[model samples]
Target chain A: MNRLFLSAIFALSFFFMQPAAMAADIEINTPAISAIKNSMQARHNQLAPHYTSGAVGLTRDGLIAVRDAKAVPLKDRQSVNTLVAAENKDRNALYKEIAVANQNPQWESDIRNTFAQRWVEKAKAGWWYQTASGWVQK
Target chain B: MKQHLPATLLALSLASILSACVTINIYFPAAAAEKAADRLIDEVWQVKERTDTPEPAATESETK
Candidate 1:
């Protein structure tokens, strides 16, 4: 029947379309992704207060940086530096891990750009983030 | 004429299928990536409240 033939064609088209739709978004819950996410969440506590106090800020390249070394007291400056270093290390690893997990390590730059934009968008009103022009508070 | 009609339909369907495949390959997927990034950032930031209220801009010294 013509109806049956058309229906079969429709079904086949749908099957091929599904993956292309899903591939647009990054996968969030694979074991490797969840592991990296957990590490980042644990680090957030250490980073949060600094974000609030203007001691550290998000960089345009999707990493954390010490925005104002003087904002932190001299006594705690070394500690803040250490924290920033550790957080940036973890963030670099997280982006690399996500790209690797997706089986397209080439996506690393795209993934980083996505994160860079999201970090700026999701930043609290008082927190600082970098833009192509310069740093802005969001 | 009937045979030619079937061949035309088949060619049209094949063309549609090929176009769909090409779109999938060429799509930049900016919006999807943004959405994915937002989900992860929200979870890590534990965003609790919306901060859209009007406020004085932060001083240059504070953001330095």
Candidate 2:
């Protein structure tokens, strides 16, 4: 009887903990996350002008793309592409880093989705960002 | 056996009560995620603080 009761108690405890274990803390940070954010911040300076000129826009999937190449001078177009690619690489890393920091790498998509909306939400007044139908100026 | 009977019954009742309160949402907490994403965005973009946006609660721990 005592063994049965103990087993029952253990089972109940496990059941209660299972859900809590599955839920992730999205804001958790670590050294990897800090490094990724720092890199992104530094790159933002280079990307800021392109954002203003409408050469690039935040994508619906949390990445950046050259929305209007004509907005940039012909000489700077290649550099703009390089900047956009680098920014996207960092963005992807940031999402993965946050998920790994949370100890649940599977949360990467959700994290990226959250960032997609946030990047649009925090975009400056004159900036451009993507919508489901098409690109829209913010 | 009699003494153990009451304890067992009490434990069972408590377990059932807790089970009722258990809402297992296996999905990630979206609100917390949005707040986190906003925090990162503000840091990376170095945007000036907007009065219209509410400050993320610093005291709020991970939603469990």
**What TM-score, over all chains together, does every model reach?**
0.76, 0.74
Per-candidate clashes, comma-separated: 1, 0
Evaluated against the true structure, the overall lDDT of model 2 is: 0.81
Worst 10 residues of 2 chain A by lDDT: A19-28
Task: Kindly report which residue stretches of model 2 are placed more than 4 angstroms away from their true locations once superposed.
Answer: A1-24, B1-25, B49-64
Task: Write one digit per residue (lDDT tens) for candidate 2, span A16-125.
Answer: 86655455346557888898899989999789878877989989999999999999999999999998888888888889988877766888998888889999998887
The candidate maximizing lDDT is: 2
**Going through the candidates in order, what fraction of the true interface contacts does each contain?**
0.53, 0.65
Q: If chain B of candidate 2 is superposed on the true chain B, what is its TM-score?
A: 0.39
Give the distance in Å from residue B22's predicted Cα in candidate 1 to where it truly belongs. Answer: 3.8
Spell out the clash pairs found in candidate 1: A125-A138
Residue B41 shift from truth in candidate 1, angstroms:
0.9
lDDT of 1 by residue, A1-138 (tens): 666666677777777777676666676678877877887888887788788888899998999999888888899999889888887887788778777765567778888888887898888879999878877788
lDDT of 1 at A125: 74
